[model samples]
Target: MSSDFEGYEQDFAVLTAEITNKIARVPRLPPDEKKQMVANVEKQLEEAKELLEQMDLEVREIPPQSRGMYSNRMRSYKQEMGKLETDFKRSRIAYSDEVRNELLGDDGNSSENQLIKLREERAHLLDNTERLERSSRRLEAGYQIAVETEQIGQEMLENLSHDREKIQRARERLRETDANLGKSSRVLTGMLRR
Candidate 1:
């Protein structure tokens, strides 16, 4: 049972690690690092599925008495991993939408038109402090959204590091379990011989 859990942990670790590394390499990622993160996640997901297949084989090779426990663990792990990936993907989409809206401007106004209008308005308002203040507010609002988008991207990048740490810890745990299992198997064999 523990061994099966370890196998699932190992696969999760590997997939998460791949995604983390890919995210780390992205430069100045745009709005939630959505595009790059999505690409990396998709690739990792494929790899994870392959690893899961191998794990299934390993579980089948175990003694029948132990198979049920391991199989249950594997199923639970698959569900958890799937949920996490789906949530992460959803986050990316939400972030992308926020960024796109900010960059392209609201539905009623295109970015280009907004910019042109701002410039014209600013020019006309130059002689009037009140109008100038209004134009300035509009421009500032756009700038603020852009800044927020950039910040969100940075947060996503930081999340990759956290994800990598989690995976590394999981990998370490799996390796420890593998070593212990090997030792126990040897001990059992020796006792049987005696």
Candidate 2:
């Protein structure tokens, strides 16, 4: 790897490790300190993204023969970044849940109040599930209606086509009759002349 590429790779590795450490520490810290750490990790993640972009540019400049190895390394780095981001997101969610529990005075303990809360949550979930099921049924009914409407439209189009063919045949027969009548009139006129 070129010197600049190596530098970017090293920076990415260091930043990724730092972010991972911060994510691990987030759950253990107080809410105020955790927020600051989360912000710092987010900013580092951005820097890591920029470094990856730089590495991509560098990879493009590399010769094809040696590029495969570097490309694999780049993919591995990206996967690592993805894992880090996922970890950070999970950490943030856990922190938020903790704060919400604290605000609700749950104190991570089970009690009568907790049971009531659980029942309420369960009821809410059941309501949402019923709503979703109703929506699904409506969608299915609509789909069936659309299919039937399409079939009706197809049948109408077929009938119109058949009618058009019948009209064309009628027009052809009318023209033939007109020609025969003209011939018959001419023959009678010749006889009258004679």
Candidate 3:
């Protein structure tokens, strides 16, 4: 495979492994450990994203044929990464809800007041989690679309560069013809004056 493909594949593999490790360990982690794990995963995810951005910039510098193939592959990789991030966040929210519920302790049939309070709290958490999920998905989709569009734009720029070269040549020819016409005009004027 091409070096670009190999680099992307390697980065994806590392990201997958890190995410898998975090998910596997999350359930078993104590509160502090869970917090630390989440932080680590977030950091690694950020690094992966930066790497992807750099790759995108490099792809723009490459020729169109290879760049298109690499861009498509990168787009696929980004979609998968987005799904993984969503899953990670969902897992964290579920875990937090479970902890909160355990702390709240459901006593035998609660008084109307207690029941209402618990219901309100649960509803709030649900709303917050839903919002988080929606935002995550939207952001991911927007980012992927931007990357793909940028690749298409770069290809268009390459085509424009070629057109620019042709225009420059045409301009030079026009200038040369104008110079010859100017000389002829000066000679005709001189003859008429004589």
Best by lDDT: 2
Over the stretch 143-176, how does candidate 1's per-residue lDDT look in tens digits? 6556657667777988998999999999999999
Model 1 is weakest, by summed lDDT over 10 consecutive residues, at: 20-29
lDDT of the candidates, in the order given:
0.61, 0.77, 0.70
Better of 1 and 2 by lDDT: 2
**In model 1, how large is the Cα lDDT of residue 57?**
76
The TM-score of candidate 2 is: 0.55
Tens digit of per-residue lDDT, candidate 3, span 1-194: 46765686687667766775575555446667878888888888887788778667767777876666667666766765786687677657755755665577745455446755754665565556545645765685577678778878998999999999999999999999999999999999999999
Off by over 4 Å in 1: 1-8, 17-28, 31-33, 107-194
Ranking by lDDT: 2, 3, 1
- Cα lDDT of candidate 3 equals 0.70
In candidate 3, which residue pairs get closer than 3 Å at backbone N, Cα or C atoms, i.e. clash?
A: none
Residues 1-194, model 2: lDDT tens digits: 57889899889868876776677677667889989999999999999999999999999999996566567667767867776787778778767866777788765456547745754564464445445544654675566557657667887999999999999999999999999999999999999999
